[model samples]
Target: MNKPLVVMLGGSGFVGRHLAPRLVAAGYRVRVPSRNRNMARDVGCVPGVELVNCNVHDPAELRRVLEGASVAINLVGILNESGHGGAGFNRAHVELTRNLIGACKEAGVGRLLQMSALNAGRGTSHYLRTRGEAEQLVRQSGLAYTIFQPSVIFGRGDGLFGRFALLLRFAPVLPLARASARFAPVYVGDVADAFLAAMSRKDTVGQVIELYGDEVLTLKQIVEYTARCMGLKRLIVPLPDALARIQALVFDFVPGKPFSSDNYRSLKLDSVGGVDGLHRLGIAKTPIDAVVPKLLGEAGRQTLLDRNRRVR
Candidate 1:
């Protein structure tokens, strides 16, 4: 019997780096699409996975990719827009989703696993608004689908812990906005497990799973924990709402959009979840202590090794 094919959109990202192999190991042939396959060569290198350079925004391309696939997984999401409006967010989230659904229908793909953010649709930021819009599209798509709304996801090369480790290492004092904004940072491995479970279980179809961890941590606490895990002593400055807005506004224009005004607005609502989806799915939630410290330790070792090599 031929193995089922699974198409993974945005499968070159950090989450994809962790998810692709699992699907492959699950006895499915995985196809990963990327705008630049060379940059995403890691995914291509995985056994039982195929990586293609394609623009997912284009409907024709999406249809082409969706062909002969039993399941389609969309991990495509952007925290910040290219411009200072909802247009970019809409295109990335809603429009692409709409196109992906239509393509799925046309291609007769039966299953979709969508990656969404927590508190989607209830925030002032374009990020959450677009997330909600995309979720709505998915709900109405009439496909066998499972939507995952995760709080922040943390792991190696993840935007949360990995990002803060980089920023925290350079500064003696870190100024943080929405310092009280809380989250249950879910482990990437757990998120992957959720996806695998949903994929295998028919009962999860059309259900929305809220994925989060055990500990409810404030933004400041997360940063502080990152510093401690890395064995560093740093001062953390929590900014009031007014100055936080200023910081977001300034950072919005930063080259890579490390921060944004819209982000601060999204932070107004805590990222903690009411229901523990990982628990509901029978997966143990990984606490920050179990994962973050070990990851930071490895990163510290890597940095030292690199420095020693350079010195030679």
Candidate 2:
């Protein structure tokens, strides 16, 4: 018997890094399409996973990748854009979704698992608006679909705690923006499990599942917890909304865009969820304390070892 094939768009991203391995473990052959195959080499290393060089945005290329695949998981999203306008967000979220849906139809792929964020479609931020738009597109696409809306996700290699840990290592005084913005950081593993569960269950089709953790913490609290985990004594100062906007503006021009005005706008809405999608899927949510301390402690040790080697 041949294993079912699953094409995972954005399978090299943080969440995809976790989910792709699980998909392979579940007896599915996973195919990940990336614009640059070299950048996605890690995902390609998975035993049953295939990584192909392809631009998913191009309609013909997307259809070619989806050909003969039983399931398509769209995890493609961008937090920050290259320019000031929302065009980047629209293209990544809404336009790509539109193209994916069309390609899925043409290629005979029936199921789509869309990765969305909490509070999608509620705020004026381009990120949320575009996510909502993509969700609507999925709903009306005439294909069997399940949408997973997760609050800020955290785990090994996560952007939340991991990012703050890096910033705290060097900066003694961190000027934090949206310090009061609240989030129930969901575990990436739980989110991946939710996707897996939904894949086998017919009832999950047409359902929009909201995934989040138990603890509701403000951004400032989350950063403080990260600092404590790393045993670093860093002063985290919360910038007022005005200062936060200025900071976003300044970083907008920065090379990597560590922060931007779009991010600030998105943070205005709290990321806490009302319904527990993990519970619906019968998956226990992993708490922050269960994972963060160990992950950060190990990371700190690795950093120390690297520094000692450099000194020697």
Candidate 3:
């Protein structure tokens, strides 16, 4: 018996790292297309996963990747762009989705699983605006599609907790922006399970699932929780909106763009979900306490070991 081929567009990213393995374990063959195969080496190492060197943004390349595949999963997204203009966001989110839709139809692909964010179409930021645009394209494409809109996701090696943990280790006091913004963080594994469950269920088609955790915490509270997990007592100063905007403007030019004006704009809307997608999908939400503390402890121990080795 031949297994169905699942083409994962952004299988090299954070969520993809967790989902790809589950697809393989479920007896599906996964094909991941990346511009640089070297960067996706980890995803490629999974059994029944294939990594192809190709530019997914290119319509021709996208069609080639989707050819003869039963399902296509688009997880491609960018939090920030090179410039202040929304051109980069449009290119990555809207344009790529449009291209993927056309490619799916031409290649006879039956299903699509799109990854999106909460409050996607409601914000003034380019990130959310383009996300909404992409969703529209998927809805009108006439293909069997399932859109997964999740709040900020947290887990091992995640950007949320991991990034803050790194910062709390060095900075005595952190000036946070949008400190009142709230989010119900979802687990990476539960999100993967959502996709897996949606794959075979006909009812999931044409539905938008909002995945979120059980706990709703403010941005300030999230940082405080991160610090406590690390056993560190640090001052977290919440900046007023004016000061936060200025801080974002300053970091816009900083290397790697730790924060941006667009981010501040997105934070204007809470990332909390109205409906529970995990529970609806029959998957229990994994609490942060169940995962973060252990991951942080391991990371802290590793960091201490490295620091001690350097000192010696």
Give TM-scores for every candidate, taking all chains together and pairing residue i with residue i: 0.96, 0.96, 0.97
Look at candidate 3 and tell me the lDDT of residue 164. 91
On residues 110-157, what C-alpha lDDT tens digit does candidate 2 reach at each position?
999999999889888999999999999999999999998999999988
Q: By TM-score, who's the top model here?
A: 3
How would you encode candidate 3's per-residue C-alpha lDDT over 166-255 as one tens digit per residue?
Answer: 888788899999999999999999999999999999999999999999999999999999888877788999999999999999999988
Off by over 4 Å in 3: 306-312
Which of the predicted structures, 1 or 3, would earn the higher TM-score when compared with the native? 3
lDDT by residue (tens digit), candidate 1, 1-312: 989999999898878888889988889999998889888998899999998878999999999998999999999999888899789989989999999999999999989999999999997899999999999999999999999999999988888988988886677899999999999999999998899889988889999999998889999999988888877788999999999999999998899989998889999999999877888889987778888899998766766676688899
- What clash pairs does model 1 have? none
- Once all C-alphas are superposed, what RMSD does model 2 give against the true structure? 1.5
After superposing candidate 2, which stretches have Cα over 4 Å from the reference? 302-312
* RMSD list, candidates in order: 1.9, 1.5, 1.2
Q: How do all the candidates rank in terms of TM-score, highest first?
A: 3, 2, 1
Worst 10 residues of 2 by lDDT: 298-307
